[model samples]
Target chain A: MNNYSTFGTALHRLAILCYVLFALFPLFWLLKVSVTPNDLLYSEGVRMWPSRMSFEHFRFVLAHSAFPVFFRNSMIVAGATAVIVTLLASLSGYALSRFTFRGKYWLVALMLLTQMFPLVMLVAPIFKMLSPLGLTNSLTGLVVVYTAFNIPFATFLMQSFFDGIPKELEEAAKIDGATQFMAFRQIVLPLTLPGIAATLGFVFTAAWSELLFALMLISGNSAATFPVGLLTFVSKFSVDFGQMMAAGVLALIPACLFFLFIQRYLVQGLTAGAVKG
Target chain B: MVFDATAGFPESRRRSLVDRITRHAEPYLYTAPALILIVTIMLAPLVLGLSYAFRDVHLLNPFSGGYVGLDHFRTLYDDDNFYRALRNTLWWTGASVLLQFVFGLILALLLDRPFAGRAIAQALVFLPWAVPTFLTGLNWAWLFNPVIGPLPHWLYALGLMNEPANILSNPQLAMWGPIIANVWWGIPFFAITLLAALQAIPRDLYEAAAIDGAGAFRRFTSITLPFLAPTIAITVLLRTVWISNFADLIIVMTSGGPADRTQIVASYIFTQAFRALDFGYASAIALVLLVLLLAYSMLIVMLRQVLMDRA
Candidate 1:
């Protein structure tokens, strides 16, 4: 509707192209160096593409390293955290959305306060607390920590989604002799699938990329998550750039898969609501 | 369609005593599991961490759990490194947030306009946020390397530098290394949120304004800016708090190094607790940080309230 001049339009597209390049260039270089053979790495001298590319680095990382175990551990922790956080967020979010209760405003304020606190404050105490219970250095401990860390934001996110659905649908279900919980399960949840998917993706990627706590809590090879593993790999190999970048690419795959889901719902105004539906 | 008629029925349902009690308890029931977990996992640890600031609780020393009232705080008062970290924290948070917001807003405005291949472009541009922070730090660090990476070479050729050198090593410029990487990683976050808020804007408002002879700039100022104000305010406020607390990029890229020029309070706290095993000192710094952050949040909130009341 605001289309005015071709010159203006060209400038806008050019600006967009710049952003895309700026966003992708670092990642592109990651892939470039990861594939470039060691001899060509220094010899080629900053060529955009390698003179000859090979999978030697990728092969080495996958075959001769603890990365695979770390990868699995990270997946399990992130996946479990996402599922648990989403489930709990859905319930709490539903309460915030649909009910008028005592202390509701305080509940909201408390959640916001949680967000404001420096998470670093909790690291030492959390380690100390978990150590006595034999929960330190375990995947379960990581999952529990991650779930609590993510809940406040996820609750807010899911609440926004729940607010978007019209109340009429659930009321109709209730009028037909269905309970509130039943209506919520059968009628409300199906419509909020997109919202749920987005929350899952957000929380999963957060737990996956979390470094500070993971590094503090876990030690040794068996239970190490990918971020911890990546750091250790760097020090152990002593600047093997190709193998490091190769491991970095491998670490990015799950996030990329979930990114597809996030973008789809995110552009749809985060839910199938009437205003932007 | 059948729901519409019942939606107007406001009398609520008849209920027995048990049902009334259940109805009163319903929201609590729904929220209990989450609330319990959060209290135990996050809230309790936070309280414990604060108390640790007053005691000597070294992790390795079995005899270290002793009351040491005000000792840590007294040391913090005199610590030169702590003061330096505070100064650096301000710089890092200010520069990172400002740059990210400006670039992110521009990106959002660009993406908001309809164009061919917009979906693909949006996805591609947002891809940086998906790259984990650790990798982002490592990747940017590598890019600034003088040998394998092209950036130092490009800067030298452009006469920005006399010789190809890594800015990550220069104490004066070391902080920029992480700030630049942070902007790249975090812009997509701001863009995604702003774009969502932008899309929620009523399209007809713009159309009506145009028909009334308002120019593009005038319409944006009178309409778009007003609509975007709340999102912009909350995002910037929360992001400021978050970015200040964020230490991963600094730790990964520079390790707060090159003569400790890049050391932020958050990274300093992490290093103390994680590397030094000095829980008492780490918790002490963390408490100060927590107080400062809380005060900052309170100030903004009150300021916003006053502004809203005026408006």
Candidate 2:
């Protein structure tokens, strides 16, 4: 029995190691190519690591290319979307959690329908709608679209988090002469900070990663998000693998940071949602 | 109480009516912004998009907004690429979902065991899910590039290929490239959800099973599988719909290239709208996909209901 348990432990550890390696390998490769000197890139082809590493690609991408502008644009759009979505989602989520009202069923159903159908379907119509408003080719346009796109999921997430908290906290405040909104603002919102953080991170990463809409809406490099810019860069400078990889690495940072922060709560939140449903 | 001189109602009745109105309006007030945005931004566009299917709406052609009933659908029916895209959608969604689910279940099972450094392991393994889909596509595309990436070289070394070649450009093998990238990116989602489900299963059930001389496999089959069934069903169903509509990786990595071998319906719709700039045809394709997905979802729900009844 002792030998058998030892064998099991070894197998388990080996399996875990494989998964970790598989998960990290592509990222590792991305980083590897990013740091490899242009001189050695072709000569040392398929190497796990180059003979010498350099930050020349990163420097070039940051300084010479339009990537910095793209990065800033992405940050602005994602940040704005995250803030707007979280704020709207919190209020609506609070309503969903605390109140039973008319149109509630339809509201939830409408959101679910949005998730089911393809957002690609809306691309042309939205372009038509926003074009007349002069919203195309603008970061503000991207933010607006992303905020709307992310609100349903974020609201569902926030609602799940709100559901986890006791209703008594708000109810007690309400009894103590606080309006329902006041109770929510002063009592409930403060308590769901973790949920708020998770929602922010989730929305930020989502907005940051959005591609098709960003591609369709924004026309030029000045307003291009990271994904669109990188794509165009790939097409324009197909030879600069090192620089493109460097840009890819830069794009990975904020998203990975946010993801690392929120991933711990992800399972807990989902379990809460599953149980609530 | 002050008297209401302006209206026929008394002061107390007016105050009560005001309170009632406020109480009734509170939830709507809270939800109104999100509702309005959803209507204008999402719902309205969705309705317009549906209408676009029956109209002649080209992005570049300003004069092409005339009603052309069934013209786009008729064109879609005749388009061989659309048919090919439909077939490819089935293959892509099926392979990606199946592979992701299997590997995800295994990963979740492995992580469920108490092991040293599990926290860091969990974080590292789940990191891929964080990589932006476009970056994931680019990263994988580069990895398959024979000149820079090691994958082709490794495959060649293993006698799996004739030469180190970029699989993304090979029509027969291009679909696999996106599918593989998809599996890598999607596995963590399934793992996370399944892991949550696994944790929710009663530990005492395993203990009881073991106490009754049930082996590990037996306990897993009797306890874990049964406990995970509902979660698996729901996640798989939702993921199927989501993945079918997901065109990011394919768009980025291959762009449905090499004679459109990787052109699933979603990507096909995107190609029509973005590349071809034919909004009408794109909407028509999208409508078909939406109907198909709804049918799939309805079928799954009914199947689950029938299974529940039988049980």
Candidate whose lDDT is highest: 2
Weakest 10 consecutive residues, lDDT, candidate 1 chain B? B9-18
Q: Compared with the true structure, what per-residue lDDT tens digits does model 2 show for residues A104-222? A: 99999998888888898898889889999999999998899999999999999899888889998888887898888888888899999998998999999999999999989999889
Tell me each candidate's TM-score: 0.93, 0.97
Per-residue C-alpha lDDT of model 1 across residues A1-277, encoded as one tens digit per residue: 4566887999999999999999999999999999999999998888999989899999999999989999999999999999999999999999999999998898888898888788988889999999998788999999999999999899998998899899999999988988889988999999999889889999999999999999999989899999999998887875699999999999989989988767766657632342544
Q: Which candidate achieves the best DockQ against the true structure?
A: 2
For residue A36, model 1's alpha carbon misses the true position, in angstroms, by: 0.5
lDDT of 2 by residue, B219-263 (tens): 989899999998898899889889988999999999998899999
Candidate 1: residue B188 Cα off by (Å): 1.4
Candidate 1 docks at the CAPRI level of: medium
Q: After superposition, how far is residue B295 of candidate 1 from its true place, in Å?
A: 1.6
